[model samples]
Target: MTIGVLVLIIISACSRVDGEMNRVERASGGSPIQVVTTIGMISDIVQEVGGTEVVVTGLMGPGVDPHLYKASQGDMKRLEDAEVIFYGGLHLEGKMTEILEKMENKKLTVAVSKDIDRAVLRSGKDAGGSQYDPHIWFDVKHWISATETIYDALVQYDPTNAEQYKKNAETYINKLTELDAEVKDRILEIPENDRILVTAHDAFGYFGEAYGMKVMGLQGISTASEYGSKDVSKLRDFLVENKIKAVFVESSIPTKSMEAVIAGAKEKGHSVNIGGELYSDSMGEPGSDADTYIEMVRHNVNTIVDALK
Candidate 1:
């Protein structure tokens, strides 16, 4: 459905729920804080930091692309009901940014990545040169910063559980620290010459910068941008020159573009293979090795190391 129609429907549905929401909010002393997050990454962090004090509803699930996601009627209702909404800003939710911004006046809407230092963020020329990469969760340290943001937001909205939120943030930060160290160590297994990552999109710039890999993408930072014939040819030539054995695909993006790249490289006398599917904009299915953020990082690192080493 068109976003305009979706918004209208949501407004109507929300008006009906307004009275009931007020009643629930009045009795919220014993209930969890109602929260809505744009993507799984934000949802997971909020859940970890909020603990028993919050109930998070993630709008985008596993293998869903935030860049291309639009709010459904159900998603709009969820946002209307939420006491607070968290999203990975920097225009990650390109289609839903307007609605989220409009909701801010009515609710405690926050961009989890807002607290990140601009100096540390990777600025790109894509999207009219004003965009910073929104995939901050790829870098463990950056994500640790985001965890603090989520914790602070939770505390601000629900001060009664400030102590619990602080504790949860501390524990999760420690885990992220250890995960960062582990990723570095595992990435060391691949030789420097093979420390190049060619993926479906430029979603891994932060990851490449953190882990010391030269990253290239078939498309720009936002998957919404298209790649031309020249772009594909240039990437293929780079693959051939470097003798790179593997190129990776993303879970949320179609692999056809990467497959085309592989075929082009073969035609030019290079035999590059599909390394493995990487969770770029989204995590794996629940109960899988990459279900959580930590596990997702581990799975991606293991995949890259095994294929490149």
Candidate 2:
């Protein structure tokens, strides 16, 4: 069923936690405010800001693509149980946009990207599609801004714990601020000519704009756009013409298209290596180096810098 239909069907049958009850229950010593996030990035930020006062459950995990992810039955229950819901917004969760929007009427449903400055974003059309680019996390400064948004949502819901949330947000935002600087410095490690970042899709436009790299992809902004041989030929031609040495594959996307581009480039004697796998639409697994938002950014930076430099 379409998410729009699901929003009408299942949601009408579900009720949300009452605001007064939420405050009283917490005041009377109840469970942490149940916070649900659509993607791991937002989940990490909400967890960092909410700290002990919130229980954050992310619907999309490592290697999951938020651009095309749909709400499953279990996901619906999780949303129903949440006191607050945070999503990447900007149509990042394209299929779930309606449900997420309607969820706001009953609870503190937030699109963290909504708090971002529109000036910094690349439109999907700009990136090769229709909506605004949703990969804001690629820009650490933007993600730090998003952290503040998550912090505000938590404080709005649970004002009693505002100070703690403030402390956590400050700490996390400071780290992100440092990360923003580090990414810029690291990107400089590559020669200006080699700073081109080619990936499976145009998911790195924000990264390119923020960190000073030229980005290209076999597919458009969203993976929903199917790639054709023409797309591969074009990218392959560009790689050969530019003498681009490497391309990166994204964890959430299948590697076949990129592999095809690499093969086609080889046919023309332009040997291009798969630079490395990047955490584009998803984070890494638990216990992995890119497990958290900060680590994920670190891993991507190191991978891109190491390969291109």
Candidate 3:
């Protein structure tokens, strides 16, 4: 395949997680709670809680890398009409960092992921080689906190539904708790020796921490980072030495690095398989099995368990 086509194939694997799809007219009526989020998963969570009460839109879509995304005319229209804007903060949206800052003063925009404890955030190489890793949704617990923050924002926007929002948040949190348990149980089914997780990017630190598995990615959390030859060689060594059964690719990032890893392992007389595509950066397209936040987590667990067990 041509490089572009290969990239498309990798991204299409993640098409399962692109939750914010082409606009659908939301249920008309009680009150329009316009919410603008950075990606589809957040939009899905807002819809789950806001129900038919909120109208939501997102700036990023399937295969659209958020680190490099630039808001277009359509985004401006969405922002102008929104009652509150919700984004995954901690530098997840790289280019729109400034836009999110400016919106803080004008709109009721909040970085819903801020509720996560700083200790849980992974650091970037700056400010003494430490900056927060912004992919907080990888862990269901952190997202549970984010859901609470979202509930507060929704209540703030439309207090009339405060009771309803709280109830919705509780319901969602319970589901997340169940998801957390399910993922752990599934990962436990993998033999202890095969519990290592290798992927295209380092977006699963929280997932590793939560599930008692080790995670290694060829690139950084953001797809903007190109996988270095050294990293790939190192990962190949790790996979071989540990006898890792499967190395997975992510839905959003290119899987060339993963292919390189698999090839390198084969060269050393160790065999490994590409487990399956994982939903990392975003959720699936609307109406697909992995579209919603809960479904996204469940599907990921099922895929991982099936492959690694």
Candidate 4:
């Protein structure tokens, strides 16, 4: 079905659930907030801060690309049932923006990165003239700020659990702070000249900015955009000239583009390898170390350092 039809169905379903929303509480007797998030990163923070007080469901899973994600019937049902919905905003969910905006009026829909300073956001080079990058979770410090945003939203939604949410936010933020320091130290092991992070797409602009690395991507910030021969040739030339040993692939994006770049570089006499698969738009699977936000960041950093250092 078309997105508009799906949205209409969801709107109809939401109206039906709106009346019964008051009857649903925490599975237990307490006031547990029902939360739905667009991406795993936001879901992790909500789960951490909400703890037992909230039942959080993430719409996107490991290796799921949010930019191309569409609202499924099941996803719409989940949104209809959820008391609050959180997303990464800034056009991250380009396909579902209109539907999400409509839901905001009916429920507590929030953009977790809404309050971030515009100065910190990377400008998009895509056709849209004024879009900003929405991958805020890459920078640990920005992710910490997002935790506060999540905390405040949770507190506001479930005032009874405000104190608990605050405590959880504090603990999670501290963990992120330590993670920030650890990532910096790890990156330092790599020589400054080798700090170029070439990837499948421009998802890591925030990461490169925060961690002192130069990031280049074959595709634009959003995976929805396509790369032409010129883009590949330019990136290939860059890798050849820099003698960069590695270019990484993203878990969410196809490796064909990076492979093409590597081949083009090889023809130009530069031997570049796939450094490792970085978690660009999504985390890893549940049993893996990169399943959680902290583990995902650590894994990406270790992969980069090991390959580039």
Candidate 5:
């Protein structure tokens, strides 16, 4: 092996016990399962369902865009040390797909959205043509399904803790179901004519579908997909024609593009206020109001409703 490869293996080995034993040690009630997750949205649900049984290390954190993210060697080490790995698939982590594929045989690598119904998935075109949008967590019902997928994966990998996973998943899913109803109701507070959600990118398609709003983005599904001045000018004209009152900025995307849209709207004798900063590709920072998945959804809904209504 090359010296660099050898060093990484040694560092990973030194960081954890052999065979990810703490997971194997579950029957003995040892350390929790070693889980490594890709995005923060997936990380939250896994933690909720796994509870005290799994210690999840999230690779992408607040404001980190998964579309443009490239895994570092340290991330590779963490993935190697993990007992089980969960990722948001459907090309969410497009750059990391090969690594995840290679690790599946050695570990129980799973896509949390694996069991979600294909019919409901949103498709968008990139330079590579069409693909399913990876922002499923924006749709509460879809995430409810993803929660069960997480439960199954946890049970599959660590059956010893099956009972715990089931209990936690049930509780969390119930709350999400309630959240589904709540948003549907809260969205009604915004007059249907005014419920348009425009953002820096098309990350909120599922959100618009679930909450009864028309969604638009300056960019396409993947932030890696470039948006030109023409795209912005077109969106600006649409906003002015539609009389859209607000546009949202994403935590993970630069605000300059959206700012350009706002400036463009002003020159056309129309005023479009920034609705609020919404947590799109990533959740809020730890301990913040929008940190968790549910709270993040709530924050987005409240921001949208307050700004548009």
Candidate 6:
């Protein structure tokens, strides 16, 4: 080959190598990472810890129930492209877990809820007793531990920002501590006998267990479970016999079922009013008071205390 032709080929190869090096440098630089979370609550936590360092997206939107949610084509694309994916495992996202598990080896996927102690969770709630209650966030104290788990995960993923993540997690936890106190004060206002929280589903079990209240729902711990006629009748009878004053409804699910429960109780000559809608199975919209984990707990406690007290 001519010397000029050989030099031209060498120049072409060098240019290609330089382009590849530039791409690598871009990736290694402190560019904001892409994080995808399964639920809004986890998304909020990620945002708190990662701050502007991350571009986080929540797969489940407002009022979207994750219990029965199936990921769309868009979701899979987002999952594949994300630098990290956070899911609240323990069967919370029932339909999406299997798919996510298969991709565990290929992607940086994490189950944030797995950080909670297994003993603290209540099992045997689902039909076959295999399904555990996945609502650890209902208890603010439990969520404090979840935050620690998240902080640790973030630090591991981005060691350079360890101190920043820790500081952010600490700040959020302090707010949560204040929230726990507020919830206690608010719940104490309810009369002991009137502290019964009758709802559409058994989602509030942990919340009730945390605070001093008797929680009953038409459906089991899972919203996916259908409320049999027996279940409905039994709950209605219990409401009438107990003369429970207020029955609450959830924001994500249809309130028609809960309203029917109220009507059924009233049919038995028991008067029960519909209290304000409770934020259950999902958190509030961004920027709303119920958006943050702390705000959500406080809102629920205040709502319950006001209606039951």
lDDT by residue for model 2 over 1-309, one digit each (tens)?
675556545555345536456756665455789989988988899888988888889999899987788889789888877888999888788778878888777767899988887876787774324468888888888898898888888777777788899999999888888888988899999999899999999998889998899999888888877889899999999999999988999999989989999999999999999889999988999999999988998999999999989
The lDDT for every candidate, in the order shown, is 0.86, 0.85, 0.77, 0.86, 0.86, 0.77
Clashes of 2: 2
Cα lDDT tens digits for candidate 6, 182-268: 787788898888888888777777778887788888877777888777887898889888888899888788988877777888888
Clashes per candidate, residues 3 or more apart or on different chains: 0, 2, 7, 0, 0, 0
Cα deviation in Å at residue 68, candidate 1?
Answer: 1.0
* Candidate 6 lDDT (Cα, 0 to 1): 0.77
Model 1 lDDT, full chain set: 0.86
Q: For residues 147-179, could you state the per-residue lDDT of candidate 3 as single tens digits?
A: 999998777667777788888888888998988
Candidate 5 lDDT by residue in tens digits, 111-213: 8888988888999566123378888999999999889998998887778888889999999999999999999999999887998999999989998888878
TM-scores, all candidates, are 0.92, 0.94, 0.87, 0.93, 0.92, 0.88
- Tens digits of per-residue lDDT, candidate 1, 32-148, equal 888899888888999999888788899999989888887887887788777788998888888888788777656678998899999888886684233688888989999999899
Q: Give the 10-residue window scoring lowest on summed lDDT in candidate 2.
A: 11-20
- Lowest lDDT 10-residue stretch of candidate 3: 19-28
Error at 9, model 4, angstroms: 7.9
Candidate 6 segments whose C-alpha is farther than 4 A from its true place: 1-29, 127-130
- Cα-based lDDT at residue 173, candidate 5: 91
Better of 5 and 6 by lDDT: 5
Model 1 regions more than 4 Å off: 1-28, 128-130
Residue 132, candidate 3: C-alpha displacement in angstroms: 0.9
